[model samples]
Target: MARRKIVRSPDLMLLRRALKHLLPGALLLAAAAALPRVPSLWRLVLELLPIYFSLVFVGGFLLAWQFDRSRIALTLLVLALADRALLHGGHNVHDVVALLLPVNLAAFSWLKERGLLTPRGAIKVGALLLQALGVAALARAHSPAAVSWLSHPLVTWPALAAVPLSQPALAAWLIAAGLAVARFVTRPAALESGLLWAGLTTLLALLAGKTEPLLTFYIATAGLILVVSLMETSRSMAFDDELTGLPGRRALNEELLKLGSRYAIAMVDIDHFKLFNDDHGHDVGDQLLRMVGARLLSVGGGGRAFRYGGEEFSVLFDGKTREEATPVLEKFRAELADTPFIVRGKRRPRKKPSLPLPAGSQKKVSVTVSIGVAEPDGSHGTPDRVVKAADAALYRAKRSGRNRLCT
Candidate 1:
């Protein structure tokens, strides 16, 4: 009996990552939101929770920034500080500044969408500094007239402070919500998902006429995003090949376990790889692997490629027969042969060059690959056996000639 070939769905992968980052934060916020229902606990903690939340946000932001230098963390930190300043010192100023919060968040989303604010860019830093300074100045300004002038339209128009459905604030929330949705649909990045949750929490807090819950939820959400980001980053390091940027053997093994029927497996090896490494040096060899990996990544015939240990690769074609996979594999092999790799001469001389010392050495090297394709046959009933069959075919191809395909 044939089993289906394994395939990883991109949408499902995105959903899994989002849930990994969001579920914990969602549960924490739910608990925090419910805490205020207990009158005694609410009164006891109300005065202290804001301070605690502020500290949590600040500390969490610092830790996350240290770990990953996240731009989102930094942005949230500045916003949280501004929020605290407005709450404590400037009641009237708070009204004015709160009106602007949504707009600032929307602008941040816009900048991120445009690629202007990246974790590595100075522009984000400059933007955050400007926002902090602007918010601080507005919140601390002692001029009641200026505060009233700025606040009157936002505070008095339609009298929605209790519901926080004012035009400016409402517009800001809408923008943030819209950005969050766009991110989930288009990118589904961890940071983007966190921002969406934070935005929702802020909106709910505004509607509930409470600050403590907002602060609590913000802190929990920020911390959760940081934790998830760190975990995901670590997992990638473990499962991804750093040199070639392909999923490693561990990922391949995982994929193999999920395979269904009628799939083809191809074992690919670079021709004379050890000789190339010994002659050209390890650096050139690494470049060759990267080049081959890039080609394999874009393999035709709906193939998924992986680095299957040292100097070896695997391509999985789910729901395809060997006949269907052969043309695709052959095309990949031909492409590798046609692409010439340029190797620059090293600055320092080495003992015993791998290739014959050049009489006017040509810097160009042509790379070729030997491939062995296998499908489910009576003898190869399991995934493991199928892989072994492909490996045996690979050896045959190498034995018969260096750059050819075997089945």
Candidate 2:
């Protein structure tokens, strides 16, 4: 009987990875809800909140620093201080945080990474310290003028006015949210997405408005999002190729560990890639890799692609032999070979070309790929051995001819 084949896709692989990282936080929130929400439990959670926040921040900050994620490290520092200032929520703590959180998120989210021990890092830290002190000073000088200033209505709409956040705070949140969305749309990344979600999570906590159990739980969940985001960011750094945006060698190895018996591995190399780099430049070489990687994403026969290393890529066809995978590779190679790759002049704009090109300056470069496919054998018992066999086949293909596939 044929066993059920487990398909592996970069998308599904990433989804599984994300779920793995998020499960603990979800379970923690669920467990909090599963237990009684009475006064006794509230007291215990509230008392322990300080300890929990301390450990998470200290540990998360160290990890972020070690990973050299200055953005994440600064964000952690800001949120922890905010929690200390506003977690208890008296004397307009909610109002202040609502007004300030969005601005802080936008500001810190976009700041480029400066090392923690550097002068710029000290300035950034000082700026945050000043903000925290300002919040503390406002909290202490809780007179009528200060209270009204913090709670003044910026939006007069009935629905918005009724929410826990003051009209002014709501307005600020809206502006900050817009900025966050714009920044993300223009330059999407892990931290921007994380901060956007974390802002929404914090807003959820703010909506509960001093409600026992739920408020603290949501706050903790928000913190967890920030912490886990750093881990995810680090994970991407390791597992994904930064240039081509394909799964890196590490991800390929991880996938190989989960393979079934009937699977074919195809090792592909761009023909004369180094010639392109040497004649043109590394930039042109980069463009070729990107074009190839983009095409590989839509490969046929249910093959998943990886940026194996350098100008080489690997594709895995689950539940297939070399014969079955050949047609797919043939199609891909034919398409790539037929496509005209343009080498633009140095001054050419990335968008519409501002100036006309000189004749023969920008010309089409012929591109081709050599591929080798292999399946596991009794002698080649392991995934690594199968890959080596595939590599040997690839070398044979290259030797015989530069633009062909072998099995």
Residue-wise lDDT of candidate 1 within 279-391, one digit each (tens)? 99998788677767777877989999999977899999989999999999999888677766656456524333566655556366778899999999899989899999999
lDDT of 2 by residue, 1-407 (tens): 65322211234334444454445445544554554457777678777876776677788888888987777788777776666666665757667877787788888767778888899989988888898887888777775476678776665677876688787777777887788667655545566666666666666666777664556566666666777777777788899887777789999999999989989999999999998999989988887887788778779799999999999999998888888999999999887887667765578666545676676776677789999889998878688999999999999999998899998
> Under the 3 Å rule for N, CA and C atoms, how many clashes does model 2 have?
0
- TM-score of every model versus the real structure: 0.52, 0.82
Candidate 1, residue 217: lDDT: 46
Clashing pairs in 1: 3-260, 3-261, 4-260, 4-261, 5-260, 6-259, 279-354
Which has the greatest lDDT?
2
Error of 2 at 300 (Å): 2.8
Q: What is candidate 1's TM-score against the reference?
A: 0.52
| Residue runs of model 1 more than 4 Å from their true location after superposition | 1-224, 344-362
